[model samples]
Target chain A: MKGILKIAFKLLVNDKGKFAALLMGITFAVFLMVMMTSIFSGVLRSASSVVINIGAKIWVMDPAVTTVANSIPMPDFVQHAVRSINGVKFAVPLYSGSATLRLANGAYQSVSILGLDDTSLLGRPELLEGNITDIFAENGFLVIKDSEINKLNNPHIGTTFELNEHRGVIVGIAKVAANGLFGMPTLYTTYNRAIQYIPSARFTTSYVLVEPKSVELVQHIKDEVKKMGYVAVTNEEFRENISTYYKYKTGLGTNILIMTLISFIVGLSISGQTFYTFILENLDKFGALKAIGAKSRELIIMIVFQAGFTALTGYGLGVGLCTLMIGLAKMRLPNYASVVTFGNLGIAFMMVLIIAIFSSLIGVRKVLKIEPFDVFRG
Target chain B: MAKTAISAHQLVKWFGEGDARTNAVKAASFEANFGEIFYLVGPSGSGKTTLLSMISGILKPDSGSVTIDSTAIWTLSKDELADFRLNRIGFVFQDYHLFPRLTTVENVAIPLILKQRDWDEAIQEALRYLEIVGLKDRAQLPPFKLSGGEQQRVAIARAIVSQPDILIFDEPTASLDGDTGKKIMSFIKDEILNENRCVLVVTHDSRIFEYADKIMKMEDGAVTTIENKSEVK
Candidate 1:
């Protein structure tokens, strides 16, 4: 088997032109696939940024809420009811709404506002400057320093802005776990101030953030919330729900899937055609080997080895290229949201394997059907 | 008495089907012993190559039996036949089908490699056979770098490296000049042939016919004559 593999390797690498063509086909396909899927994953991550940064164990909200960004405000009674549940350690009303901000320079920008519970400040971001308690002061809010921070001219602790023509002051500079995807800066304030400054319907509580007393009691709390005509979901389940909504209900997911399928087909066609041509050109040599005592199984192994080696090499090159491009883009453009994850790599690897198997089957059929007599009779 | 190395009985082969069918080899029978060079001579379309294919366990005979060294080759399973061909027969093609990408030594090492010999051991054995063919110095060169005669010698070395009991050559010298052809035949008889092996040569290149111990002539699809050349020589 070792000898046969050596022969297979020599046969593959010795034809420099064909080998390079095969590698390039697979590499380009993998690059496109990983790039598309990684961008989609990063977008999905950003879509649920609020859930990720808040770190709440359970969220009680109206059943229609699909993503954290599109919150459906529930009446205040839902928060009261959630707090009254037996397993609930604590529950607080959270107000989430988007408002236009008048920057210090008089330029206007859209910003997402999160209103944390005034007493506990349960979801307050970690402060980079100023004091978290200062959020209680007159017109005081915390500004998150993220990729979209510059849209507000890079606000500091003393920066003042206007929301709905009401005076607003940044008391703290803070950072969160994830940045928003819609190119909007985020501001943190108390629930009372958020509703006072930003006009909304009478139902202003967007979600009721809950913390269960124990992990075992989360399901019981969810069942209790269900009876109240609302939904309760753990953090992970909420994230999955957001992912499912984006994947199935939006054009973004379909576009990415189509691009990935195109990449796979491009790789398959190029590699399969080139491999078949290689086999055709080497038909006589294969026939000679067959005549001289190479088994059908050995020949099959040789074809598979050749295809697998090319596919894996191309996959490595593609991943390396995508990583380098993403790194360079992130350095030059801070908002570039493409992440290389294990899931992305696994998807690309599986596609490349399919390409390899398809190419190998093409070669295997040609090689096994060869007749040494026909070759020699020529 | 000399040992019978290959014995064929009433071999038949046909191609196509129905009205399009044509007999390629028809009831061809012959025997060759160890320690002698046997030549099968015929014109184009005479079924010489087809007959050789059936006897060498490559093309299955439509109706016949071939016994090589007392083993009825047709009765063996497909894999067993492949093993038999690998260990018991060495074939030389008319075009000297050397893998152009491989160095000469690697090409010659194929049979030993097929036999599962260690890489280093197979190369060493191949080098020994290359020396016998007097082309040891060219072992590292690719087949394209060698002359027609040298390439033919590489094919010959590849064939005999495994020391199979039967060495079959299909029009071995068809692409070579007369002097190179005679030299190849002379070299094969002098160094490669022995009392334990049978050498079968298929050719119409009469220039090297004088070296054959027996010549079997065929016309159309059947054998016409078997001439014992040893007595004349």
Candidate 2:
């Protein structure tokens, strides 16, 4: 086995130009698959981050609300109906709205405003550089993620911006996982301050976040909230809803899938053609091996080993490159986080493996068809 | 007779179909014995190579039985036949079908590798064969790095590495100069051929005819004559 594997490796690397070309093709294919799929994964991750980070047991919203980013505003009375449910421990009015902040340079940038409960600070961002009390200071205090500081002109504690011509001061720098679907910077503030920041219609709240008395009662609360003609979902369901909405209703999922398939085909073509040609070029050698006592299974084993080695090496390089690019992108862009999860790696590994198995089979069939006597004819 | 090492009974092989059909071999029966260097010499396309192929278990006759060492080769399963060919038969191609990617030592190690021998031990055994073929110094060089005669020697080393009972050579001297061909022929007759192993050669090179213990002359897919050189001289 080791002998054949050594021979397989030698055959692949014998021709330097061919080996390099084969590796390049596989790497490019793997990179395309991983990076393209990861972008969509990252988008989905970001789309659900707000709900995921809030950690609410149940969310009550206007029945028309499809995702956290696109929700219809409900009157504060919705919280009262939600709090009245049998299993509801407490319900808080949650406000979410989009606003354009006029930066220190007078440039406007879009931001998502999140309203946390005033007394409980139920959805407070993790403070990275400022005191929590700074969020309640005078003049519409905004607690922004430290990662988003550059988007807000690298403001200090008192540096101010304007949202809807209302004075907005950055009083706390916090680390938060929330990212809007369209990659808008997030602004965390008290519920009352959020209403002043982005005043809307007669109904101000977008959702009523509920804390179930017990984890087991979440489903019962959701049923009660539904009876009230509202859409109520547990945190997991909300995350799934947002994911399903973006993945299927939009073309994002299909586009990523098509791109992944295209990459797989590209890898297959490049690797398969190179391998077939390699086998053709060395057909006599394989025939000689067969004539000299090597079995068809042995030859097939050699071909498989060659294909496996190529796939594994190319996949490692491609995934490493994709991770590096995402890492660099995250460092430069505030909202770009890696969506290449362990699941994504498993998928990519399977893709390369398919390419390897399929391509090696092609080569194997060719070798097996060769007559050991043909070598003598040459 | 004389303890036949390989026997082919009424072998028949045809190529193509209908209008393109051509009979390559027909009822070709022959037996080669151990302790002799046998030669199958014939005109091109007269089925000398085809007959050799059938005898060596490389090709299955359409309507014949080939028994080597009392085992009906064609009757064995594909895997069994493969193992039989690997452990019992050795072939040296006319073009010296040495793997270009492998070094001389590695090329010689293939048979042992097929036998699932330890890699280091295989190399050691391959080195012994390489030394026998006078290629001990060229063991680490790729086949292309060697000269034509040297490459043929490596092929010979690979062929005999496993010390199989039956050794078949197809046009072994077709690519070598007169001196080199004679030298290779002498090496085969003097060093490789033995009382327990049979060496079969398919060649048109009359210069190396003196090395054959017996020669079977074929014409138009049938043996024309069989001559024992020791008695003929």
Candidate 3:
């Protein structure tokens, strides 16, 4: 088996031009696949950035909410009801809304504002500078230092901006786990102040953030919340719901899927055609091997080994190339949202495996049909 | 008495169907003994190759059977027949058929590799066979790098490396000049043939026919004559 595999390898690589062409086809396919899926994965993660960054155990919201960014304001009674539920350690009204900020440059920019509970400051972003207590001062706000921070002229602690004719001071510079998908700067303020600064519906609570007393009581709390015509979901479930909404209900998902399928087809056609040509050209040699006593099974193994080796090599090259490109893009363009995840890798790997199998089958069919007599008769 | 190594009993083969049907080999019966060079000669389309294919266990005869060393080859299952070919026969093609990517020694090691021998041991054994063909110095070169005669010698070395009981050469010298052909035949007669092995040569190249101990002639699809060279002499 070792010797046969050695022969298989030699046969594949000895034709350097064909081998290189085969690798390039698969490598380009894998690059496109990983790039498309990674960008989509990153987009999904960014779309749920609020849930990921807030790190809440449970969120109580209107049942109609599909994503965190598109939150439907819940009435004040919902938060009070959530707080009254058994197993609820605490429930705070979270105010999430968009507001236009007038930067120091006098240019207007859209910003996402999150209002934490005034007393507990639950879900406040970690401060990179200044004191967290400063958020309670008059007109106090924490500016999140993310990719879009420069939109507000890169505000630091003590930087002041105008919102709805009200003075807003950056009391602290903060960092969160993920940046928003939309190109908007994020601001953190107290719940009462947020509603005061930004005009909203009569009900200003976007979601009721809940912390259960214990893990075992989470289901019971969810059941209790459901009776109030609101949905209760854990942090992970909320993120997943956002991901599902974006993936199934948006054109982005279909576009990415189509691109990935096209990449697979391109790789499959090129590799399959090239491999079939290679086998046709080597038909005489295969016939000779057959005539000299190589079994059909052995020939099939040789073809499979050749295809699998080429596919794996191309897959590695593609992943490496995509990683390098993504890294370089993120360095030069901060807003570049593409991440390489294990799921992306697995998808590309499965596609490459399918390409290998399809190509080898093409070659194997041609090889098995060859008769030594036909080869020798010539 | 010389022991029989190959026996074909009234073998027959045909191709196509209906109006296009053609008999490739018909009732061909013969015996090839150990320690002698047996030649099957015929014109183009005279069924020499078809008969050889059947006798070598590659093409199944429509009727009758072939037995090598008393084992009916046609009666074995497909896999068993393949194993039989791998273990009991050594075939050399008209074009040498050496894999161009492989070094001469590696080409010689193919049969041993197919037999599941250790790669290093097969290479070592192949080198020994290359040495026997007087091409040990060129063992590292690819088949295309070697001269036609040298390539044919490599093919011969590859065939005999497995030490099979029956050695079949199909038009061994069809592509070579007369002197090279005679030299290949001489090399085969001198170094390859032994008391325990049967050597069969299929060719219409009469220039090297003098080396054959017995020559079987075919016309159309049937054996026309069998000549014992020593007896005639």
Candidate 4:
């Protein structure tokens, strides 16, 4: 009713400081949730292509690729049997091993050396920088695009570096459509050289490229690969495997859940407490409103309206601040992206609104208890 | 046989219950007519406030009935009681219960807003009352920023702004000095004589006796006497 609104506005404007603080609390909580969720989504989106970038529609691992982190070595002849399956385009064998990339300054960085088939029809780098002929001809490595490319703090087109106890040249940089799942800075080379660098690496553990004739035949190809005593997974399936590992095993999801809960409690407690005090301070005015013809139900509407407005204002401000933070993050967070999607913003808004409304319940209940007669008494 | 604005019969209100019950207003009865300044005079704790609260439909008596303009409120449901209270009664408290956060005019406009009047119209009406109370110049000052007497006038303005049928005051002059109380009582008397409304004051401030059209005295838990109508106006 008009009377309640008039009074509500007066009360809010009177104690501007308290209400401002309450709105700030709500905004901060919502901002954190929005920012965190966006980052999670962004990282998950880019991490799904680890196997896809190897130009493989169907991957054949040695039945021991345990939950994305595992890469078991399979016998190199598995490619021959996979190529004999119907709807099989071609099969390229890939040998994989890990070693430390020791720079000239002795700073060691972990790298994965992938031994690829030179005579196959799949799995090639899409170069983004430097010369591809130098990379193909010399004993060298190709770095990933969108990565920091400093060699001893200065990047040269033809820099020679010793990595994994062997000296190799940095021929070129290329960006593949897919990146590695386990984040081991993968470098590709001929199958012969991988064994020379890491001897006893005779068998290639995985098949890099196997294109299905049609989308419907993908499952058929996977089933054929599984018959060979190997685990066959599609590109999308491989990405899911990696995502499932970090989400469940690394406890990253649990950390986010806890922080979100903490934000809820903190926002609710502060907003609710101030709202209760606001009601108490204006009890006499409410009683007067009752005396003036405001139904108890009408007063309830006023409370809900105030709570909704506060939440909206807070959400808008919080999102604005979070956007500013994200802009700053893009420049500061080395190769890190904090993605804020529409869905993330929507969910964050809902969270803040729920907290604001829940906190307001206490204050509204107290308002209902005030009696018009109380105004006439002490 | 004047048209009765308020009627209470055998109204009994008790505080607490069982082993600790204290009788506040025991079987009290009264009536008042339109265009009259009525007073309930007594010492503190003499059931004056309890009687006024009952008349205002704020506190329901344990036994007996209250009728406003011949509509028996006791026969109605709780929501009906609230409706009757809100629509028919306006109140002034002893401590000048103005909303300290709002200006004098905004506080006065509250009931009108509660009545769902247009915001500007409500403010205009409230400002009219403020002018009547000689606070037009102080319309924008928050109640807390005003003097004690000015605040009391603002409370009075808020009470009468809606133009209710009945106006009830509980020690409206209690917190003010004698001269200010006299002025407030005179203003209240003029409002009763000129506005065709019923006004009741429950007060221990005997200095206001000259402004009353009728004076009822209470003692213990009952009405003791009714003074004859006066010509204070």
lDDT of 1: 0.92
State which docking tier applies to candidate 4.
medium
Error of 3 at A87 (Å): 1.0
The numbered model that scores best in DockQ is 1
Task: State each model's CA lDDT, in order.
Answer: 0.92, 0.85, 0.92, 0.74
- The estimated TM-scores of all candidates read 0.96, 0.95, 0.96, 0.87
Question: Which tens-of-lDDT digit does each residue in B109-131 have in candidate 1?
Answer: 99998888998899999999999
* Candidate 1: segments with Cα more than 4 A from true spot: B229-233
Query: What TM-score would candidate 4 get against the native?
Result: 0.87
Q: Give a tens-digit lDDT track for model 3, residues A144-235.
A: 98788988887888899899999999999999988889989999999999999998988899999999999999999999999998999999
Each candidate structure's count of clashing pairs: 0, 1, 0, 4
In candidate 1, the residue pairs with backbone N, CA or C atoms under 3 Å apart (3 or more residues apart, or in different chains) clash, namely: none
Docking class of 3: medium
lDDT (10s digit) by residue, model 4, range A1-378: 556665666677567887797788888888878777776665655555446567567777876574433566677678778878898877777766767677766686676667667665156578777765555576767766544444233435566667556777666676766344444566666665666666454565445457777888888888887888887888777777766766777787677667777876777777778777777877777776675567888878877777777778888988999888888876764345456889888888878878767856876888788887777665
CAPRI class assigned to model 2: medium
Clashing pairs in model 2? Answer: A293-B86
The stretch of ten residues in a row with the least summed lDDT in candidate 3 chain B is: B224-233
List the DockQ of the predictions in order.
Answer: 0.78, 0.77, 0.70, 0.56
Off by over 4 Å in 3: B229-233
Once fitted onto the true fold, the runs of candidate 4 whose alpha carbons sit more than 4 angstroms away are A1-10, A35-69, A77-97, A104-107, A112-127, A131-135, A145-148, A165-167, A174-202, A207-211, A232-236, A341-347, B192-195, B229-233
